[model samples]
Target: MSEKPISKGKRSVVITGASRGIGRALAHLHAAHGFDVLAVARNFKDFPHHPNITCLPLDLTWSDAIPKIIGCLNATARPFERLINNAGIQVELDLTRDVGDETPALIDREIALNLTLPIHLSHAMVPLMARPGGTIVNVTSLTSRQPKSSAPVYSATKAGLASFTSALRHQLAPLGIRVVEAVPPLVDTDMTLGRGSGKLSAEAMAQAIYDGIAAQRRIIAPGLSRPVLLLNRLLPELVAKILAKS
Candidate 1:
């Protein structure tokens, strides 16, 4: 990815789940490019950041804090031109016919964190994106297209974002607010440590992500993720079998 050009004219950017993984990489990349970064996460204090980065300790899962946090971001001279909604969880929701549970607790939790929180954040940020060059980069997963048996709810949430990315691209295009999906393959993060194979380094994934954003590629995937997406399109059932084996 081309180094985020200083000409991009970004004064500030907001990235969630910035304690580690891809979120942290993007934060550093933005800081290096002279963009003030607002990093939000549960353990944000643990992450070291550049002078330009402001760490906001926020639990996005706490539904009530959304408006207040967004207000703080908006009360600035320059609102965020880039918004990366990467705060999501990989939850295990094993709902089966024989299962006896009072409620679909796992499914509800996944929807809240993985889907609802991001949606709420985006809704709050849309008004701040009054400028002509705003961007929204959602860090989704490869499992959106290759859902396996172990984490159906996780995949479903990502798949929803994938679809939202497409529709949002059209909706926001006229307004100049580009919505892109950073669909990563297995990366060397705690989220995918035991779940993925042939993982790419976080730095490499970060580079690809920024490149895709600068170039405005709607679906961003590094390493072999693009090929895998293509293969799944051509041979979905075959790809399912392979993913099931994994």
Candidate 2:
């Protein structure tokens, strides 16, 4: 599908998972700031309708379609200043439970969306973003610091993405493209549902993300993520115990 024509001289940003929650907030924030936004997600029935925002509804779990998606992006006349890898899914499956016929498929989809899709998108987009001041933002989770007991696969995928972001930052530094890791604590999104207490609102988290990017912060850990990351470093055993009980 062709991207909506953007006005001349507007900076562009690509944000995945832009249909709701933090992603939606980010899309609105950037659009409000006069950035041409390419918002990608599976559903766009409720996506924002703005002159600066172009909604592309596509399921990110289809890994093979990534190249075509990137090609469509590259064909656009607008210059891409930022790529926010925000599309993710969490499957809370107990490893101890009996294996169901659908278990493997669910696990595969989780890994594809959370880890593989970002990697593929970044791999393709980095070359296009070789210009100075370009940035890649990966939205990981606090679960990366301490794996959750109920969501083992989801936690593992986040942890893997965290490692990839770290290595990518150093690799892309010489190219003048910054790789940023946004490790958010439990956000009050549909993904979390009824799980977290005192979770940061999506708008608040989106504002923090914008601020962090503007400041060029390599790691943006908002709310409880700040202290939790510190505790993970300083008191590994205590952090593990706490996570186990959580």
Candidate 3:
């Protein structure tokens, strides 16, 4: 492991989109693992009330989201040990201008939530991250390695994040922070509902992610991600054809 092992205890973990799916599972998993979890989500009505979990209700797409997050951290008077940029949106829009009924607003929102927000959050959280053992986990997708025609914008954003994660890893290495790019296969979540079959459960994916972080891996590609990525490298066109249909 190139990164230092994270010390166990009540260190804070900030997770975006923690109301459901992978983020929610991660919040609970970390809390169970002895980390103080700060769950950030717009909806908190169904949030799991745990002693180690604190809910922060705010739209991550808002203009002042970063400031509000920073303010919250400052109020806690504690540097977070981990920041998981897990909030993202996927919109199926036809880019063809003539027959397409796509809204520009939706496209902007998707990009903002998926790509732009993570970049800004990573930068803002640097100072607030615990030194020497701080870790940043950026959740990307297999669609990142290959573009998906159905969710073209989502593909683009994840691809952008993947590149950013690599560069950030190098940049933060000297600063004693570890940046991890976590790639999960299609999971059984609201996002993928009715779209894919044989999806991995969010709980399982969360466990894989936690294990990856514990192992201090720079790139945590879980489930089919490892094989898909290897195949993509050897046969880009074939993989692209398969993922485009996914």
TM-score of every candidate relative to the true structure: 0.89, 0.95, 0.93
Best by TM-score: 2
RMSD of each: 4.5, 1.7, 5.1
Per-residue C-alpha lDDT of model 1 across residues 1-246, encoded as one tens digit per residue: 111212233587888888799889888988888887877778864576477777777777776658756766755545468888887788665676526574376677777878887777877887777457889888888788878677888898988888887887888889888999998877898787676568898778888988988897888988888988899999999988887887
Once superposed on the true structure, which residue ranges of model 2 sit more than 4 Å away at CA? 1-3
lDDT of 3 by residue, 1-246 (tens): 011122334588989988999999999999898887777879888775777787888899899999988877776746679999999888886787424444777788899999999999999999988888899999999889888777788999999999999999999999899999999898999998887788899999999989998899998888789999999999999998887666
Give me candidate 3's TM-score against the actual structure.
0.93
lDDT for 234 (candidate 1)? 97
TM-score of 2: 0.95
The TM-score that candidate 1 achieves is 0.89
Q: How accurate is candidate 2 locally (lDDT)?
A: 0.87
Error of 2 at 130 (Å): 4.9
Candidate 1 to native Cα RMSD, angstroms: 4.5
Candidate 2 residue-wise lDDT, 1-246, digit = tens: 225764546688889898998999999999999888888888888664887888887898885557666766766744578999998988889878939999999999999999999999998887667378899999999888888888899999999999999999999898889999999888999998988699899999999999999998999989988998998999988999987887
